[model samples]
Target: MSQTSFQTPTNKIVLSISQLNQQSRNLLEGALSRIWVEGEISNFVRPSSGHMYLTLKDDQSQIRAAMFRGQNQGLSFTPKNGQLVQVRGKVSLYAPRGDYQLIIDHMEEAGEGALRREFEQLKQRLSEQGLFDPAHKKDLPDIPKHIGVITSPTGAAVRDILSVLKRRFPAAKVTLIPVAVQGDKAKTEIVHALDRADNFNQGQELPIELIILGRGGGSLEDLWAFNEEIVAQAIYRCKIPIVSAVGHEIDFTIADFVADLRAPTPSAAAELVSPDQQELQQRIQDFEQFFVSTIQTQLVQQQQKLTWLQKRLKHPGQRLRDHQQRLDELDSRLHNAIQNALQLKKTQLRASHTNLLRVTPTHRITQLKNQQNNLKHRLLLALQNSNQHAQQHISQLAQRMHAISPLATLARGYAIVSDPDKNIIRTSEQLQVGQLIETQLHQGHVVSEVKRIKKK
Candidate 1:
């Protein structure tokens, strides 16, 4: 080889392959530490070490990528060849091959990732508008009398809800408001169903007090209808209390946020709204036992009181017999007392008669009778003598009275004059002309009217 003299630059720095790769990696990480890339996954490999190796590509270009065990462990989905995904990682150069690759920290399916972003954006907007406010939530009825179920007619969700309702509370009437749970028409059908249910309750006596909007477990895309703003608005505007049971426990939707209650599953929604018959039966049994026990206790107490009363009570027949014996004794004593009183009275009467006889004065009574006869005879003679003297005095007085009496004057033809009033008139001056006057004779008097008056 011909020797050619060349001047080396003094300030130039040299680097080895490893050092260059290292520096490139550091610069890449510093620049693109956390970038999000979306592409189709190809040549995916998960070795026994649990680290995943894959090629991220698009129709125009492709890039090498890796996810270590620590980073890939938290991935919600498994990575496979030909699956489209979005990854978040830093750009780094591998030292072994000097190949620049993306170190993925997180990965998700591409469709789901877009859906998730949309979901978050809608959630944020609705939240700001107060659609997801707790204050807007309604209270679920304790025991709904009528329930409306909005779901596909043939889906597992309706079957599960109906089965749970029938088992837990058969009395709760179920009205199936069948609707498409997913697809382009799912949102419109659900909103219409909710409106129908709400309107039906308003116009019905047995109204739908509650509604269950539910579907079986599915991917976020399958459950997208529930996340629609129209469905959420319908749920919010519905007068009936709604329970959202849209997917598995981990899944969430806008309808769930706007609903009065969010149940993890369709079966759980049924359970929440209905009361358990078994618990009610148990309580009724407990009440029945308590009532029976109380009645039994009262009966025992009353029976004990009755027994005590029976022990103390005497027979009426025996009481009446004792009273009759006492009456007989009193009757005998009264009879003896009456007989003794009569005998004593008879003895007193006989003694009184004898004493009366002994004290009588018979001879004095005869002497008094003779003395009364002699006094009577003497009194007769004295009365006869008094009568003779009285008769003689009467004759003398009668003769003297006859000589000076007015009757004798009347017998000699002299009369007394009087006025009409029988008043004596001694002078003619006492009479008035044409007045009636009387003249007295021995046997009769005469009445005459004066013809004339003469003054003396």
Candidate 2:
């Protein structure tokens, strides 16, 4: 019965426009704040102010996203439409437009595979063009006097490099080629810096022997400018050797492959280009000490040898006296030897005279005649023996001569026919048709002519 009376259904919850907007903003901001979203980028736009506006959407949903100038400036690669990306940001309602959006703090390509694929493609193209060949790489100077640095002027990398160089070798000179290390203009600036550093060799200025290209530690995106193909090519084409120090120990880039050497950090690159001055000084001192000690030792040895030689040296007067004594002894011995030999010869002659007298007849003429007769008989026997031996030798010689002589063969019923002018015979090949010939025989030689030719 109480509901019988008709009344207009009414519910009152009054709110102002600012209050509505505030409530909507609070609800949306509270619900979707500080989120991580993975989606494909679409409708991407980069304004001249260096701000990025884009839509991130999955198959079922979509959201508007914005990366402001401050955040976008730090990015290495330009974000493109349809790129699979992950964004970290807060979801907030744009109060003025009355729309939900994401305020992105960070953005990255979705997976490592995509980045690796691009890397491989670029590497392949460069390799095919001979950019990555070992033969094309320049050799680093063994000792660099002047090293050029291409990096950010105000950075930890430069400081570390300078510290290391100054400590290792204070005398080495370093020149900085300052350039932007990040942002859109970083690659171009790096290329320009390299060119400028390389071209600095003019007139009387000493050319830079080495180059250190480096940057401080950062994420992959933060170091992506060094991975660009153009940067790699520039490094490869540099006539001077380049040491790449792009990031930390674990980081590597295309520049690392193209450079002549790679350092783990900027400090390491500086250390590579210079020798330790303190260590070198210490080594020089050691060598000097060694040399002095060696010289002293050698001098002592030579002095000992000289002392021995002084003791061995004899005075000229004493040497002459010794030679005179030896000569006198030799003269005495020679006189004794000659006297003994004369005595022995006289004794032998006496014995021989006695024997001769005993064998001789008393009459001088008869004895002489008997002696002559004996000598004549012996001489005749000797003469006969000599004649027989000579005959045997002559016969042997004749036999040997007969064996080798062609004349002997011809005497044994053979004749030699030779071409008169050539004096050649062994075969018919020496004769031509109608050629005059000389025939040699044991009896005589006859002139002849070739009437017919027979070869067999």
List the lowest-lDDT window of 10 residues for candidate 2.
1-10
The parts of candidate 1 lying over 4 Å away from their true place are: 1-110, 288-456
Give residue 303's lDDT in candidate 2 (0 to 100): 100
lDDT of 1 at 404: 98
lDDT of 2 by residue, 305-348 (tens): 99999998999999999999999999999999999999999999
Q: Write the per-residue lDDT of candidate 1 for residues 336-442, one digit (tens) a residue.
A: 99999999999999999988876679856877899999999999999999999999999999999899999999999989998877899998779888999989989
Per-prediction backbone clash count: 0, 0
Model 2: lDDT of residue 8: 52
Indicate which candidate wins on lDDT.
1
Among all candidates shown, the one with the greatest TM-score:
2
**When superposed on Cα atoms, how far off is each prediction in RMSD?**
36.3, 24.2
Clashing residue pairs, candidate 1? none
